[model samples]
Target: MTSGFWQKTGKGLAKTRHFLSAGLGSIFKKKREIDQDTFDRLEALLIGADLGVEVTQVLLADLKASVERKEVGNLETLRDKLKTSLIEILKQVPVAPPIDESPIVTLFVGVNGVGKTTTIGKHAKRLCAEGKKVLLAAADTFRAGAGEQLSIWGQRAGAEVIRFPPGADPSAVVFDATSAAMARKVDHLLIDTAGRLQTKHNLMEELKKMTRVISKQIPNAPHEKILVLDATTGQNALSQAEHFQKAIGLTGIVLTKLDGTGRGGIVVPIVQKFSVPIIEIGVGESPEDLIPFDIENFVGALFEEENP
Candidate 1:
C-alpha cells in the first residue's frame, strides 16, 4: 500500500482509534500496577468499541495472564500487548490462496446496501490498472437498476459488463458471462449478484444456482466468494456473516465504510467467527480508497496517536 493510502486508513479509523485510546490512554498513563478495576475498565472499552463479547473476554484473559507474569509494566508495554493480541486474532484467518490462473472468477456477495457493487467496481479498477483484461457480470437481476449500477461501475473501471434484462434469470447471466470470459480469455471475471437478505431462502438458492452454473462452464470456478460487509453495522454484521457463510461458504470478506463507524473493532469478531480472510477494506468513496488488508498496518493505525 502507498503511504497516502496508509495515511487515509489511519485517518479513516480516527473514530475507532479515539474511542479506544481515550479510555486506554487514561488507564495506563501513570504506569501503575495492574489491578481488577483496570481490567474492568479495559473490558468495557473493548466492548464499547464493538470487539464483541467473546473476543473481548479472550483479550482480557490474555492481558490478565501477561500482567500476572509481570510481562506488562507500563503504558507502552500494555499497548504493545493489546496490539499484539489483536494481530494474533486477525491472523487466525489464513491468507487467501494465490490467484494465479487467468480469467479468475470471483463472486461478490452480501445483504442489500452493503456496498457490494461499489466494492466490485473498486476491485475492477484495481485489476484494470494492472493492465489485466477484465469482465464484469451483472447477475443482480432482481433489483431494478442493479444491472445499470454495475454497468456504471464497469464503465468507470474501464471494463466490459455482461447483463440481462432486469428480472431475468441471474443464473443465465452468470452462464453467459462465464462463457464470454472464457471466449475472450480475460484475466478476471467478476460477477455481481443481487443483494438478498441471508434469511431469504429462494434468493439464497438462486445464488447457489448461479455458482453451479459458473462451475459447469469452468470447473472449480468462482474461485473467490467474497462477502462485503458494512463496518458501521457492528454486531449485526456477524449475523449476516453467519447466515451467508452457511449459505455460500465465504472465501473472503470486504469490510466497507470503516471511515463512518467507530466500531471498526468488529472486524476481529467477524474474522474470529468465520476464519475468512479480510481481503480488502474501504475507507473512502474514491476508487483508490479500497485497499488490501494488512494486519500490521491496521493494528498500527488503531494505536497511532493523533497529531498534536
Candidate 2:
C-alpha cells in the first residue's frame, strides 16, 4: 500500500468514527447491566443517527436477544455487537464489477454542488495512473461552469474531454461521447451529467434520456451509474438518494467531503436502506485523495485515534 492510501483512508475513518461515536456515545458509557431502558435509549440513538427505522428496530431486537441468551454483559461486549452488526449489514452490498475492457462507460449523477465533476476528475487521473486511457464527457451543460471546470480537470489528468456549448442537450453530448469512445478505443469514459434537483421531473427525464441514448449506441454502456453524495448534508442526502434512485437506477455511490461536519453516520443508513455499495470515498482535495472503499479499513479508520 502507498502512503496516499493510508493517509486518505485514515482521514475518512476518523470522520466516520466521530459521527458514530456521537450517535452511540451515551450507551457506550452506560452502567454494566443491560436493561429495557438502556435498550430503548440505544434504539433511539441508532435511529437518530439515521440508521433507518427498519435497521434500528432489527438491531435493537437482536441486541435484546443476545442479552437474553447471555451473549452480552457490558458496554464493551455490546459495542462489539454494534460494530459487528454494522459490518454484517454492509457485507450484503454487492462489490464493484470487474473492469477489463477498454472505454468502460461510467455515468456520474447527483444533485448540484455535490462535487460530481471533481470526483470524476480525480477518478480519471487515478484510472490513467493504472495505465488506462481515460476520456471525460461534459454532459453537465446546465450548470454555467460545469464544462469548463471538467475540461480543466481533464487536462490535469492528461485525458481527452468531449464537450458542447452550454444549453446543448445533455443526452446528445453523451450520445456523441460514447460513439467517439468506440472509435478511439479508450480504456475508460467518465461522463459527468447535469446535476438535477430531486424535485424537478423534467430534469430527471433528461437523465433517463441520457441513459437511453448511451445504451442505444453501446449496448450496456454506462455500465456504472455512480451517484456522488455530499456527506455534510446528513439525512437530507438520503432523501436525495431516494429521488435519484427512483429516477435512474444507481449501481453504487461515491461519497465526497467525508472529512468533517460529524454526519458520517448518514453512510450507515444509505447502506442499510439502499444496499448500494460505496465503491469509492473522497476525504481531501488532492487527486489521490480518492480511494477504493474497504469496509474493514473504513471501520478501523473511523474509530482510529485522533492526530496530534
Candidate 3:
C-alpha cells in the first residue's frame, strides 16, 4: 500500500486510536511494571474496546505468561506484546487467492444497512478501474428501490446491471444474471443480494437457493461469498457472522463504517472467531475509501501517533 493509503487508514482509525491511547496511556504513563493491577486495567480496557471477552482473555493470558517468563518488564514491552498478539490472530486467516476465473461471480451478503450495496459499488469501481469488464447482479428484489440503488452505483462504476422488478424472486434474478454474464463474457460479475436479517430463516433459504442457481449455471461459480459487516454494530456483528456462516459458508468479509466507531477493536474478535479473511474495509464514504485489508498497516495504524 502507498503511504497515502496508510495515512488514510490511520486517519480513519483516529477514534479507535484515541480510545486505546486514553485508556492505555494512563495505565502505562508512569512506566508501570508488570503487576496484577496493570493486568486488570488492561483487561478492562481491551474488553471495553470491543475486542470481545474471549479474545481479551487470551491476549491477557499471553501477556501474563510473557511477564512471568521475564520477557516483558515495562509499558513499552506490554504494548508490543499486545500488538504482536493481535497480528498473530489476524494472520490466522489465509490470504484470498487471485481471481483467475473469468466472470468471477462474487455474492455480497449481510443484514440491511450494513453497507452491503455500497461495498459492491466500491468493489465494482475498483474492478472497472483495473480495466476489467464488470457486471452487477441486482438480486435484491425484495427491498424497495434496491434495484434502483444498485443501478445508480452501476452507472457510477460504468458497469452494466442486471435487475428485475421489485418483488420478483431473487433466485430468478441470479439465474438470469448468470446467463447474461456467461453470454457477455465479462471479466467480473458482482452480485448484490437482498440484505436480510440473519435470523430470518426464509430469507436465508432464498439466499442458499440463489447460490445453488449460480453454481448450476457456472460450475464452481459465485467463487466468492463475502459477508459485509457493520463495525459500529460491535458484538452484534459477531452474531450475524455466526448465523450467516452457518447458513451459507463465507469465503471472506468486508468490514464497513469503521470510521464511525471507536470499537474498531471488533476486527480482532471477528477474525479470531470466524477465521475469515477481511477482504476490504470501508474507511470513508467515497468509492476510493474501500481499501484492501493489510495486517501490518492495520496494526501500525492502531498504535501510531497522529500525524502533526
Q: For each candidate, what is the lDDT?
A: 0.90, 0.81, 0.90
Give TM-scores for every candidate, taking all chains together and pairing residue i with residue i. 0.96, 0.91, 0.97
**How many clashes in each structure?**
0, 4, 0
Runs off by more than 4 Å, candidate 1:
28-31
Residue 19 error, candidate 2, Å:
4.1
- Rank order (by TM-score, best first): 3, 1, 2
lDDT of 1 by residue, 19-101 (tens): 88887888877658789888988899999889999999999999889988999877678889999999999988766659788
Q: What is candidate 2's lDDT per residue for 206-272, written digit by digit as tens?
A: 8889999988887877888999998887788888889888988998899888875455656778887
Among all windows of 10 consecutive residues in model 3, the one with the lowest summed lDDT is 299-308
**Pairs in steric clash, model 1:** none
The residue-level lDDT of candidate 1 at 91 comes to 89
Model 3 CA deviation exceeding 4 Å by range: 306-308
By TM-score, the better pick of 1 and 2 is 1
